[model samples]
Target: MKIDSRAASRTLAEIGNWRAVLLHGDDAGLIRERARACVRLVGGSTDDPFRVAILDADQHARIEEEAGALSLIGGRRAVWVREVQDSALAGVMAALSLDTDTLLVLEAPGLAARAKLRTTLEGHRSVAVIGCYPEEGRALAGSLSGLFRDASVSIDRDALTWLSSVLGADRGAVRQEVEKLILYAGEGGRLGLDDVQDCIGDSATATLDDATSAAMAGDRVSADTALERALAEGLSPIALARACLSLMTRLGKVMGWMDEGKSRQEALKQLRPPVFFRKAESFGKALERWDRETLARACEAVQGFERACKQTGSPDLALSRRLIAQLCLGPRSFRG
Candidate 1:
């Protein structure tokens, strides 16, 4: 069984069985929510949140064996594997093929068609695969309308478009912006584009947004300065590191898609905010400056910074500056 993220309500209603599910998306929260719903539907109690079983793929097979083999402690059992990508899931999946009583949730990032685990779950009648992507246009419209209707607020069409366009591939940001707008506009107040402009749109390209642009545009000085400003603003270097990695990754995917003969407009549509209309120009510059191999190297550099962020209390600002300076100029020249 496959459930689209857009059909969240319907999907929630249908997730009853204790089978396998592959919940994937860029938004980390939605995947958990859906999985929780599935756990609840399986007669699992939600009051005791920790009652649900949580395990990594390092022990997935062992956990899977135990889940299907024994009954829970008078409660439902759910085995959740986090950050387990499709390629690494072969043995674990092969193990799960032998049983079906426990709810197995495989949590991963976004799903490309090449994702083998996604394909397997899609083809499995006993398994469910759910994909969640950023919502836009009609989906967002319906969402905003729902949000407004819930609070009995009214928003103009232009304001809605501005909201949809400004919030990039970030789902949480969109939700937050809407919630902020609701409060700013107050209950029953009709919001126009000016209201959005006054609130979020005014600061659209204020801080990190500008830095993202500079980095994407291959402006080494601007990029470095932007990183400094962002770090000064208390944005964790780890978060910025991930954002840098994500920008390269998304830009590469979009560029590859365009190279496959996708129109510029189509590419624009495929990108999130900043990348769509306003920021696409800079992203194109970045892509031209750094090819696929360079982007791959950049990803590796970010991985190093990720480790530095997790393992040590290093001055991330200085480390980040060094990394950005090295990256903006060129690749991290390998010694070997």
Candidate 2:
């Protein structure tokens, strides 16, 4: 009952029979999407107040009772438990024992291999645990195809390649871009590379990429401009801050290699997406300004900022912007 990315499509297509499903991964968008798909396949709708129930981690104590209750609207019931982790395992186990037409969907962040909930769910015949990591290469291309196919949109190979590259790892972003493309294509319209270029070119993703690069490279003015553009394009501050944290984490790895006697060129060369030729100098400068320890601390700060952003009554956007600005100023400011 453990599903990898390659098998995700088939599993999603035939998910109706699953009594309990745990969708856990770092990709929040994919987890939510799959959780929603599970509800849809089981003939449940969030719009229906009585048939569908959404619960958070703290409300898990009610899960067992909720799952056993009959649907008021007279259809299959779905109980979606968000943020399921070690603490919610007890309630999950209780819900799993229910002999009813209820479908239990548990949405959680990335769980470790040895995680109790993951192990238990994967060991059960009636439970399914899907690992929703980011897809790449052929897998990414195939996912894009499936998405466009579901939308009933025709896309040429070249366009598919271009579109896939333009889209990021987030499934939600992919869904939004595909939805936009479908609207642009109208009914039964065939799309080409030019169509993708025209519709999704210079999007928030491109801007955010530029901003992260500039921010890490110590170019405050450029980073500020790019951040403004990204924010203007409707990219949330939390998303942008998370991107910055990812970039800094990558940069820290390169810095660690350099400290271990690797040349700047060699270190940058080792990066998966390899630093761009035009920005190699900036990356080198970033390395010169911050060391491994500082990057580690900065990562902690970014993580704390993310959590604070999620807390009730916090001005997440403003907090994210302020923290990002501090990061752009360098590790010295980050520590202060």
Candidate 3:
């Protein structure tokens, strides 16, 4: 019962027929959004106390009991379990075996492809497993278009393109920003480039992108300043490290294409969420300065930074600054 993205909506519409639905992926926001959608589809609303039972990882043990409970109001109930872990597999399996009509919705983010819980439930006929990854490129643009269309707001092509490039990092963040844009425009209003820029030009994601791009281009002062602003705006240290890694990964891909005989412009054009025009010169310079081997090492270094930030007692902010400094200084050995 594994569902692809195209079939996800259809499956959710028919969710009442399924015993349980397992939503898993790296995009935690999308997982929660889909989980809420399932809840609303099964029960009338997500906040209905009588028909909706919400459980967290620690309360996973009660999943089965909640799933089997009948509603006093005489309709199907929905039991939502958030942040599910592998330890909850048994309870999930037990819940799926029940004969009741109540729906079970499990939000399990960061599950690997071969994780025991994912593999066990993926093929279950009565369970639906959906992967909720981050949307990018055309998918992201289309999503933004649909959001605006549904809100009855009109967005110009330039605004849509710019928003798509900046907003697809997280679904929940995109939704929040889109809601703001819609409110700013009001119903049946038109949104131009100026409107979106006025609304979200200084978003945290944009700042993080600026920091990573500056660091890649060895602009120490600009990188440090943007990093500071991003941190102050609530961007996490691990997220910053991951953004650096992502930039290196994209640069590495474009370099690979160039090595395969494609012109620099052609290779750069292949990048999803193509390099922002403002940053294109620096991005090209970064491609010229860092060879593939150096980019690989930089990726490793950023991964290590992420790991360090996750450890107890680690000085995350200091480590973040050090990582940015290393990137901007162009060290021969990032391991240092």
Cα-based lDDT for every prediction: 0.64, 0.77, 0.85
TM-scores for every predicted model? 0.55, 0.70, 0.91
Task: List clashing residue pairs in candidate 1.
Answer: none
lDDT by residue for model 1 over 171-258, one digit each (tens)?
4455666788889979888889778778875332234455665765657888777666666655555545655665676777777887
- Tens digit per residue, CA lDDT, model 2, 20-137: 8889876788899989988876755665777888888779889898899898669888898898888888888888887887989899866767889999889898888888876644
Off by over 4 Å in 2: 72-74, 110-114, 156-159, 213-220, 234-336
How far residue 210's Cα lies from its native spot in candidate 1, in Å, is 3.8
Best by lDDT: 3
| Global CA lDDT computed for model 1 | 0.64
Clash pairs, candidate 2, are none
Better of 1 and 2 by lDDT: 2
